[model samples]
Target: MSVPLTVCISAGEPSGDVYAGMLARELLASEPGARIVGMGGREMADSGAELLIDIRDSSVLGLVEVARSLPAFLRKRRTLRDWIRDNRPHVLVTVDFPDFNLGLAAQARSLGVPVVYLIPPKAWAWRRRRGRIVAQVATRVLCLLPFAAGFYRDAGADVEFIGHPLVDTIDAYGLPDRRGAREALGLSDSGRVVGLLPGSRTRELGCLLPPMLDALDVVRESAPDAAAVVALSGSTSDASVAEVTAMATIRGARVVVGSTYEAIRASDAVIAASGTVTLECAIIGTPMVIAYRLSPLTYAVVRRLVRVEHSGLPNLLAGRRACPEYYQSDVSGRFLGSAVTELLVSDAARDSQSGAFSDMRAKLGPPGAMQRAAAIVAETARSWAHE
Candidate 1:
């Protein structure tokens, strides 16, 4: 009898954890006898990957946060490297978290283990030199975006555009009934609802959310019947919610945690921090304004490196501004409020935006991305064993 194939995986943030979990589930279903081990969070562990390290311990963002956690991160890295060296798994699959995952890929490559990268680094966006490093280390790169495949292919890496996992996950939830959703949340169906998604990261909330709240106050003045609800990330602490909640209540706003989709579906419009949530809004056919602010140093560094003209997924995918964007210095309460108010009043604007969103969703292709990615990994492992 052939020995069961062993695979190791690693992810460094909540988003990565969710994606890793989905991939792990698919792998187990496709290859029932396979053994999976990894450094990830609750989601991946729940999906049956043996957890070696919890992702929370290493999920810091920004230069300052990483600097403060450097010693501990280094220690964790040493432990993970040792585990990889000792176990010699048939394959090491990395999902996002490029900084840590790239180093691990290199180590696995040196040990003659194949490395598969999902959601490969955004080298086209920044640090182009890293593309060469990826080409040297990764045996295969499974990309979510079509452009990402071209970028890696040009860099001499074997890359495939496997369609986006969001297509599979988001559609499964289906669209929420707007009036029913409003009633469930105790919000009046007659009033206009504006969804506020600050972000999942503490640093993002601290820097970007206060300005968003201030902007909502301006929005309320223009549209007196408009009510705002902040969608709290599951990863954010109660203390963080408290700060935003106090501010929101002072301005007559509502706070909803854990169910971001319901909040988004109920909203007449959305004011979201620029990231995956923008993609979610597009998928749900919600019109939105995308806003983001980074630390001064990080913003400056990113300005020089990003090759793309837009940051929001809706904007990037459409190759046009499907929604208003406020970033870095442009992310002021006044600017954001003006944008949101415009979206609230213009039916033509919302219709046009929603149309673009539908088109983008179609471009994302069909569901079952996780299952497809897993099947590829399983086939590769089986082929390696034969050789």
Candidate 2:
């Protein structure tokens, strides 16, 4: 009997945790006997990946926040290294969290373990210099977007576009039926409805949700019958929920946790923060007005570094403003309210955005990306065994 190859995976942030959990699912499907150890949030652990540490509660936004996390990072790094020395896994799979993962990749490489980076750093967007470290450490870069293949390849890494994992995740559940979704969430089955996705991170809710509530007032003025619902993530704080609940009482919007997909399906449109949620909204054919705000320091630093013209992924995928996006100074209740109202009331505008979503969907590669990546990881592990 052959020994199973072990894979150590790490995903530090919320979005990465999602994809890492999906990867863990596929890895288990592909190699049932293989051991998968990871550091991530509930999703990965729920998928049965043994976690060394859970970064679900951890949120760091800017350089200042990153600096504060240095001690914890050092401890995590040391622990993973010690585990690597003793366990000697065949591969270290990193899912985003570039700052932490890149260093760990280097160490894993030094220890003669193959490193595979799933959703490697967006070095093309900023810090192109960091791609050098990814190239130096990782044996393979499994890129989620086709556009990134050339960028990572240019960085001198062995790169493959694994397609967006969302395709499969979205497909597995199938599209949400609006009537059913509305019923499930206890929302009205009729009239104009819009989703409010402040963001998955705490900092985002603090900066963004107030503006969204104010915007909802503007939306209500126009579409008096319009219903609004806020999708909540597991990491959302109780205080944030209390604030949203209070705001909802005054605004007549429902605040729902753990029903993001249903909320997206149940809505006529979504006012979303610029992140993975926008892509999720797009995949479901929902028209969204994307709004974003960062800490003054984080916004200042990010604006200077980000090379992309669009803040929303759908817009980025379209290479143009398929969905209207407001950032920093541009984010306003009046403006966001106007956009949301237009989408809810105007079929032509909503159809145009939905059509753009169809085009964007075609470019997102195919479904089953997690399983495909698992097969690749298994093959990579075998190659390491021979080496």
> How many residue pairs clash per model?
0, 0
| lDDT for 365 (candidate 1) | 62
Q: Name the TM-score of candidate 2.
A: 0.96
What are the models' TM-scores? 0.95, 0.96
Q: Write the per-residue lDDT of candidate 1 for residues 195-258, one digit (tens) a residue.
A: 8898877778788778888888789788877888888866667787888888889877899887
Off by over 4 Å in 1: none
Q: What are the RMSD figures for all models against the true structure?
A: 1.7, 1.6
Q: After the best TM-score superposition of candidate 1, give how far the Cα of residue 45 lies from its true spot, in angstroms.
A: 2.3
Superposition TM-score, candidate 1 onto the true structure: 0.95
Q: Which candidate comes out best when scored by lDDT? A: 2
